[model samples]
Target: MDKKKFPVLIKYCFLKGKNTVKAKTWLDAEFPDTARGKSTIKHSYTKLRCGEMNTEGGEHSGRPKEVVTDENIKKIHKMIATECVHHIIDEYLGMRKLCAKWVPHKLTFDQQ
Candidate 1:
């Protein structure tokens, strides 16, 4: 109820009363809401901080460009080029046949 008590309340809530003088001074200067009243502050802070509201021009917001090094491009090319020889042969032969030592198959078909 008393004006002096307001500072004490803020000091108790924000800084644990270690520096009540500084806490009261900061609170008065900033006019910050009580911690209990921070739901509105939180929404505003998040919108402004994340540039969702577009109030600050969002100098730090956007999708970053994908980073592709030479090795990464080479790896991607190799991945696209990779193929299962058995799958290719089966597609063309119309049968499941082993054409090479590396082509996998059931143990019964290991002969061919």
Candidate 2:
């Protein structure tokens, strides 16, 4: 049921002269829960017919596989530190901003 094995088995069925539907059926019977779809079998069968025998996938272009790098962690930590300091300073001054307007940190009940 390995992902790579699906294509290999599909290729085997192709070499045995089985059509796409038959190949899919055989795979489904062998790997009931993990069989590749008809479209996938057909695609692999097409590739086999075209003489591309390598079953493994080639390198593909897409978004990077990793996003949480050390540099990104450092950047986020620095941003949070600066924002925290700014908030502390504002709190100490008993002042806060609301909708771009300077407002007192503590408001009267009527103001609330």
Candidate 3:
């Protein structure tokens, strides 16, 4: 249910002297098969009863920021260049099979 409607529903229930359970029952009956469940109704009731319910939602802690700036780009580019050149030299010069034991497992899998 929309957060905007919570205040109105809570107000109506308040005026009618209905308990949270009664309000929840009415909401479930009215908005059947909805995303809103018992927990949502109960939470709204708790907020309304505690005088914390507001029109605007509170700020939430979301995913952490992962900014890939110019420094990160240059570092990644250098790593890729080094790895590719090493692999190319080993494979083209026929040194890969002889030195296969020395090569890292990750590099072998990547080459394949």
Winning candidate number (lDDT)? 2
Model 2 residue runs over 4 Å out of place are 66-112
Clashes counted in candidate 3 amount to 0
Best by TM-score: 2
lDDT tens string, model 2, 10-53? 88999999999888888889999999998888888778889999
TM-score of each: 0.23, 0.56, 0.43
The pairs that clash in candidate 2 are none
Q: lDDT of candidate 1?
A: 0.47
- Which candidate model has the greater TM-score, 1 or 2? 2
Poorest 10 consecutive residues by lDDT, candidate 3: 97-106
lDDT per model vs. reference: 0.47, 0.85, 0.65
| Model 2 quality (TM-score) | 0.56
The local lDDT score (0 to 100) that residue 110 gets in candidate 2 is: 92
